[model samples]
Target chain A: MIRLERKFASLKENSKKALVAYLVAGDPDISTTLELMHQFVLSGVDIIELGVPFTDPIAEGPIIQAAHDRALQANTSLDMIFSLVEEFRSKDSETPVILMGYINTFLANSKALESIHERGTDAVLIVDVPGESSLEDIGIQNKNIASISLISPTTDNDRIQKICMSSSGFIYYVTLRGVTGASNLNEDEIQKNILNIRNSTNLPVLAGFGIKTASDARALSQISDGVVIGSVLVEMIQELSEKKDYKKIYNYLNEISAAINP
Target chain B: MDNLRDLPNSDGFFGNYGGKFVPETLMFALKELEDTYDQLKSDPDFLKQIDQDLCHFVGRPSPLYFADRLTKHYDGPNIWLKREDLNHTGAHKINNTVGQILLAKAMGKKRIIAETGAGQHGVATATVAARLGLECHIYMGAADVQRQSLNVYRIKLLGAEVHAVDSGTATLKDALNEAMRDWVTNIDDTYYIIGSVTGPHPYPMIVRDFNSIVGRELRDQSIEHFNAFPEAIIACVGGGSNAMGIFYPFVSDPEVQLIGVEAAGSGIETGKHAAPLNDGHPGILHGAKSYLMQDENGQVIDTHSVSAGLDYPGVGPEHSNLKDSGRAIYLAVNDKEALDAFHMVTRLEGIMPALETAHAFAALDHLSGKFNKKDNIVINVSGRGDKDINTVATMDGISLD
Candidate 1:
């Protein structure tokens, strides 16, 4: 089994939920981002999702969009992200690292993608490509790296089945009917949709999008196997980037992790 | 080439371009739109309503005026203008907006959203939304909001809210990004009325079909007025709606040549232009696969053009296929050349062409010797220059204020 499968299996064996933390690569700077990765792991993050910045992040809200802008301004590239993952692997190889980005950026760096498995990356979630389009459909074929798929509140039952069947790592259930950082969390709707997804596939379902607080993560984790936090942590990173305040971020991650685990 | 109009396939690929490269939240919406459009495209009541609006409301059948002075100045083909400048809202944008708003009404959407560059499309969409009594919102780049303030006021006067998008390059692409985000957020009752022949799947097809009225009218008008088909058809391509509007009907006509003019802001060599077909490679932007002005890192770079409408990093997917297949010839003209054409056409033809349309007129300077004196050369004057006076005056170092 791959790293993601093993990680999820271990979590299920322990009867615990997973906590995924997302940060943009090269945001602020490269060395700081690498340090943040180590810090995230130390803070009890089960999975690391590194955002590969693109010029137009249409799916993201203002906060994450600003993060992408800062990352691009720092000249982050696919090679640098891969190397970051490789360096992270040197210290801690247990946790799975997923690269989340737009389609064009991955398509532009197909060579780097072909070697991602060797470079310690586990999965990829391209926001624009969606479930109907496999990476292979767009002329990208890598059997090693798991292809993650998203199921939104707008996704119908038929598309949900299709998306779930093709997805590998885990089913990402968008908690609300909005972009990242949108605050409206209809927990009832999220629970219903996640249940609908679980009926179709046995893969672990993780709720993401609009998940901000530890309470939100804990509530979502009850209905699903895990929860992915993105925009809020990215916002905090930007706020504390100048001061290099990793301890505060680590504490916040620890609080969220403890909330989800119990 | 045989089934040129039957392109974009069931999967929305014009050969190798065009597809749904959007987030998962928008997929069902795109599919729903495609299904709805397929049902209503040939419905008699829908067709009748669209026809009634085109004839009565929009004042369709805009005259095909022969520009005698412009022809004489070029000393080549007889220059004829397909006067889309005379359409409702002062541009051809209403042709697509009217059809889309009707679709929105049929779909029971209570809100309408759109993105604009020069604000002509925003005004057109707002006009239809006001007519239909639907809530309307227009997203425009902050830079373009300042450059096209006249049309901005026109859109607001039509009772639509205008949102100045101050993100990215603060241009059309950024406006499109914000519009997509809004649509994803409010997918239940909101209908996004895409202005150009761009975006994912059904949008390019729907916009092309609605705007295809231009070519359908031109076909009969050319034979009626000239007694023969024009030797060439020329139009300016921003996201390529106007050019595609005229080129679709004549794609199978072996005798007639199709020409698309792209905006070269300074020069393509200067690396500050929007001539994607001329100087770009195949990539994806705003949900469609097309020729894009992007860096090696796959990041879309900023594009430049005096005409705000044409300052985009990518062209429509069909245009990319056309360029690859040699079905249409693409050319580019610089800002200085377009500015010169702006003055020349206003003086010689007594018609002030939009800065975007001036790019098409400038192509005559390059194709001057290609046609005989008797050959008819039809050009799509896509919009009027009333909105561009401020920019032109500022270029001459004079402030209208």
Candidate 2:
């Protein structure tokens, strides 16, 4: 089984919430990116989403795109990403690392998702793949590397059911109708979407997008099983990578994880 | 995952180029298009609709005519012309436009908007929309309106609202700017049917796929009629859809020489040209990175040519890819050479080709130095020359008579 499922099942046993940290792979270099992934888990990151770099990433915020651009400029390939995941397993195998990226890069890189079943990667979140066309249909729904899903404010009720039914991992509930980092929380809408998603499936619903502040994470924690922060973590990388140290990113995510718990 | 030619990721693009790139909000929609277009490409109903539309409406299998007089002028082997102008709306634009209108209707979109240079794109869009019963709007420059009044009337009569753009230069580029704004704002209900095989990602792939029929037909027809493939396949390159449509299939055939002729305006050495592949550097235009005519600061430089259709600052990414691979060769033809061919085609074969076609004809003359007269070359005569009558009349310093 994927580490995410093991972690979620353990969360039910321990009666605790999970903390997910998202980072763009190859932001600085393969070595530094690998170092950052280890630090994320050390800082109590329950789950990790390593963003695959793409030439054109429209869905990502400026900070995330900049990170992807840097990674792409360094000529980082999918082989390097899978190797990073495998390395993550050498030290600690408890935390899950989901490979998240645009469909083009995913199709360009991954020969067969099943081939990487034991590569230590947990799940795929192809941002451009539809709910109706799930990972199971494409022969990639192996228990070791299932597919996570993103539910937007624009997704209709029928499609939400389709997504919840097709999705294998915890559902990521997008908080707004705009791009990443474009909007803050709409409490009522988030609660309503969560309630609707809750009625559809037993999957743990994590709220992401625009959870930039500590207080935002705390508030979202009150309503969901986990809070996912991507752009904020990437923003830290952008700020600290200028000074040649990504340890600041580890500290920043730790702060958000602390806020959600308290 | 099926055939490389299969739908959804046809030409290897999802939503045709409008794939997921940004925030989570837009990701699902683009994915829907990606998944839908792929499956739809092979669906029996989808294939039937597209085939029926092309056969009865847009018209299919444009003729392969032997340009005996023009071929004899070059004093070469037999040169044949694929008559895309014989299609319902005239030009190869209808082939893709019709397919997209069907796709738009299938996608449940209600309105259609198109951008035009010299009104050919507008005419093509309006023709498809009228046949499909979809609401249509066309953005054309005020300058193009004055030049192509008949075309404007043709589109308007087909039940489309023509928005005369008064923007900078008031030409095709400005018209496209307005059309993009409309698409961005009303994307929920509108489908922007791009004219050429340029733009970001999927547009290059989609427009090229739609236009590739020209090449597919030519490939078979050349074999059926001549019993062998021609030595060269040539076409004019604007955003390079027609050229790419006819050139892409033959690119893999090493024996078949593929050439794209660019509008060299006065002369390439003079610095005023729309010869992007011939002169431009790699840069961004309409989103995707490709060969572009830009200045030192990377600002897009305005281009000039006798044909309004060819005056663009960039070529498609696939062309850039093709150029890098050396699978194809590009050449530039000046105004004078194109004009001379313009008169030659008119006098010899009674075919008044668009100024764009004149450039392809000029390429045949230019390559006479490279290949022997025995080497057969085929030119894609994209459109009729009626739109250029006034421009051609004022130039050459002579009357129509």
lDDT of all predictions: 0.92, 0.77
True contacts kept of each: 0.85, 0.13
**Could you give candidate 2's per-residue lDDT for residues B1-401 as a string of tens digits?**
11222322433332222222233354344445555666677889987988888888866878899988877777766889999878887788888887778778788989999988867888999988988788999998788888777789999999999999765557776677567656544557777788998754456676887888899998899989888888888999988889989987776678888888999998999888889889987655454556778654344567888888888777777777667667778899998899988998999999999888899988877777666666667889998888888778878776854
**lDDT (tens digit, per residue) of candidate 2 on A3-120:** 7788999977876677888888888788878888888888878988898876445456556767876887687877788888888789988888888876545544446556665878
User: Weakest 10 consecutive residues, lDDT, candidate 1 chain A?
Assistant: A132-141
Quote the positional error of residue B302 for candidate 1 in Å: 0.5
Q: How accurate locally is residue A100 in candidate 2, as Cα lDDT from 0 to 100?
A: 86
Q: Can you tell me which runs of candidate 1 are displaced by over 4 Å?
A: none
TM-score, prediction 2: 0.61
Model 1 C-alpha lDDT per residue in residues A1-262, reported as the tens digit of each score: 1999999999999999999999999998788988988988888999999999999999999999999999999999988999988998899888899999998999899877888899999999999996966778777778898889999999999998888778898988888877999999999988898988988999999999988888999999999999999998999999998887668888999999999986
Which of the numbered candidates is closest to the native, going by highest DockQ?
A: 1
DockQ of each: 0.89, 0.08
Which runs of model 2 end up more than 4 angstroms from their true locations? A1-262, B1-30, B397-401
Candidate 1 lDDT over residue span B1-401, tens digit each: 88767898998999999988999989988988999999999999999999999989999988899999998887888999999999988889999999999889888999999999999999999999999889999999999999999999998999999999999999999999999999999999999999999999999989999999999999999999989999999999999999998899888886889999999998999999999999998998899999999999899999999999998999999999988889899999999999999999999999999999999999999997799999999999999999999999998889777
